[model samples]
Target: MESATLTRPPAGSPAPSGPTARLHVERWPLIGLVLLCAATVFGFFYYPTYPNYDSLYSMLWGRELLHGQPLSFEAYRAPTQHPLAIVFGAVLSLLGQDGDRVLIAITFVSFIVLVAGLYRLASRAFTPAVGLIAAGLLCTRFDFPFLAARGYIDIPFLAMVVWAAALEQEQRRRGTPVFALLALAALMRPEAWLIIGLYFLWCAYPASWSQRITYAAWTAAGPVIWALTDLAVTGDPMFSLTHTSGLAEELGRAKGLSAVPSSTIDFLVRLDKAPVAIIGILGFALAAYLVPRRIWMPTALFLIGLGTFVMVGVAGLSVIQRYLLVPSLMVMVFAAVALGGFTMLEAGRLRTVWAAVAILTVLGGVYYTTTRVNLHVFENELRFRGDSRNALEDLLDNPKVRAGISCGPVSVPNHKQIADVRWLLDLPKSQVIARTDETQVERARRGGVAIYAANRAVLMRTVLIDGMKDPIMTQPLPGFRFVAASDGYGAYVRC
Candidate 1:
């Protein structure tokens, strides 16, 4: 692609000077491939680099697929989550692979593929040189890589988001390639729609107003097409969306906006421990700076796509920046430009300074990655893992307590675990509890429960779990046996 500037590069046009430029451009891909590979290997080899909560659930759903179970719109509660993820999970299970390993691998590969897609898309801009710079910076972004290597939908959604942008102008013949991939992704995670919408903008930008409306209709056709197929198979065209939207706000109003700043600090400060994120951000910034002027239309379109997305923060994600991952990844493209050394900067002194900044950003990213150990590998070292999985199993140790409820092969005790304990225990309840959490004990005290239990660790966990404890009543149950185990969680057994 030729530069759109009045002056060519050598005349202080901010373009590369000297014979090495083209050669460097040609070699951009190699660097992208190497950096991506390095980040991926590091992420997977370490302690899965994924939290054991939602990350683990996606893996479990995938295991279900491997077991020949049909994807029930109701079975895996997050109706909007991509079904493709579960399909991927099932395949891993069939191959007898560990769900975590497979999910992490898929995440890593998808990220690399997203970078390649960006490289292809960027080819229309800077020489391979600038594209490689973009790839490298993106490779080290503060948040993208960390989430990119998990079984979660954000990374894959991000890849598709870029892909849509690349095809912005290409006709359907070259656009929408076997949207089964998109459908599956959309099914597993509803947020993939953000990518779809962004890609649609890139695709429809060049059309006439009438044609733009047509393009809008056409872009939505992918989901419509899937809905029709779903209807044909399941007799409910909108079952997934209908089923999912209902559950979106199930958690209700969460703790609120305080989580945003805390998460931002986590994302940025984390750069010290995982430099790959910074590398990615800087490389993307460089690409933004170097993208050919003609390519600005598409890049601008990418930004619009991203902006609209975050504004639509879903019911479950309103309070946290982590939920902003979808939009964050999208904007990172422009951010790369920002890091690439400011597109608005004129050639000469400021440009030189911007270049210095970009170089420093990239250098800082590298230093962060090299020095940051994958400390999560030793996450198990800490107690109160924040994981609810197997928590019920571990806590209900008494034979009589375990015997009261029957689950698995034998009947789990008749007692059903209450709200907030769903993930760590069986759901849909074998038997209803009088209440859950705070209300639970109150009801148990009023009526008659053989045993009253509460996690004492809830009070002591002031340092670890956020919102760990709500409150224990000032009044005590007459015969309650309060047991505060050293595990940082307490158990109360009522006689």
Candidate 2:
């Protein structure tokens, strides 16, 4: 944590002075970038931030945990996501309100930590300029800032990965703290588990037989603990991994092992869309010729891990750009190494190229900050299809609607339908029934003959509910009368 310098001048030499001197020696640029990222996040939250279904699910899970409720939620809660939510929920419980503030705090702190970690890694592995470049580029990489603002589980997990990798050499001197951090990272995302495995594989090459086994054993603790925790939480040892696999299959994202070529192409294409990626790729391409041996293991892990992730589509996961953030950072480190070599070039032409790279990086940073910062406030309005679920909930003031049927219980329905019902109607998993099956539909109908409600979007999306396509309020089933309706929803009364 000492002040990072571009170089250490000779002892007894006059140290540099003034703003230019401070610019070369100080961490202020990194600080400035972090502040910019934080400001952008603040701008995003100035509006009512409503996250996607996963965020809502996490909050609900966390809220239940805070209330001392059992883990009775029907959906699979992955180990990587739930712990953070539970902690967030517990904190929210004490705060009385300000859940949004808590979310923003977690994300902003993680963003800052991630920036700091990247700077440290780049500084140690390459140079202060490289470190500064890497951090600055990350802040500007459009998705990076937004992802942090959204407060997903990835940023915190990535922060741990960055710090662990940065301090990896110190692992030998300081003991097994990096392993502990990696273990925690595994609890955040399964990618760290693979990284740990890959690290141990690299360690095995030069290590003595006993040393190799000890190191492997040390690395095994993370996955082993993860599996044990999964067993304890879900009663299935591999549920987190397996459940994700099944969900991916259901979502039609699973390609088994056959998706390697296309997934790799897709991953690369998506990666290139990030503004910082081109520079990182250029640096990595140059690193192949220059500084080939430096940080070779981390470089290989990034390639192999990413290639395998693309190929196998781990846990049947879809290719998300943010999933590659850690590997991207690795490439950025390699790029920094390349830049370091370029700066040391003997020829004027090569040095000019290095200067251009520096100039491009600085300009990119400015452009990213200037363009991405804007505050757009959206009203906290809840509209399910055309009907304002918010208005209906207020008008009805019915507690039973909390457990009432709206859209089908299964996830095949439009996500907004499920989320709206869960959020506005307060529907619990047990009371919900899948409308996909005639048996479930009949059962739900017979169980409650008084009223029925469903969102039209779900009806439109699924064939099973295609019977409910009337322009006006109309019964999709017999013994039901058209009662009232909203723009996106239809309500019915049983005769």
By lDDT, who's the top model here? 2
lDDT tens digits by residue: candidate 2, 1-495: 111222332112333689887677675664676576667565555533433445555565566566666554344322234454555555654653355346656766787888878877666554566677667656645466556655666788888887877776323322256666776776666677777776777667877888777777768776787677567667887766677666565545535556656655466445434444565677766655544433453565477557647644544655555566667667656555544535434457766787787777657756774786442211222122123434334423444332233432322122233433444434454444334334455554553322224554434433224243332222345554455444444444342
User: How does residue 221 of candidate 1 score in lDDT?
Assistant: 56
Error of 1 at 461 (Å): 8.4
lDDT of 1 by residue, 380-409 (tens): 422233332235435545454444334221
Weakest ten-residue segment in model 2 by summed lDDT: 377-386
Compare the candidates by TM-score and give the number of the best one: 2
Candidate 1 lDDT (Cα, whole model)?
0.47
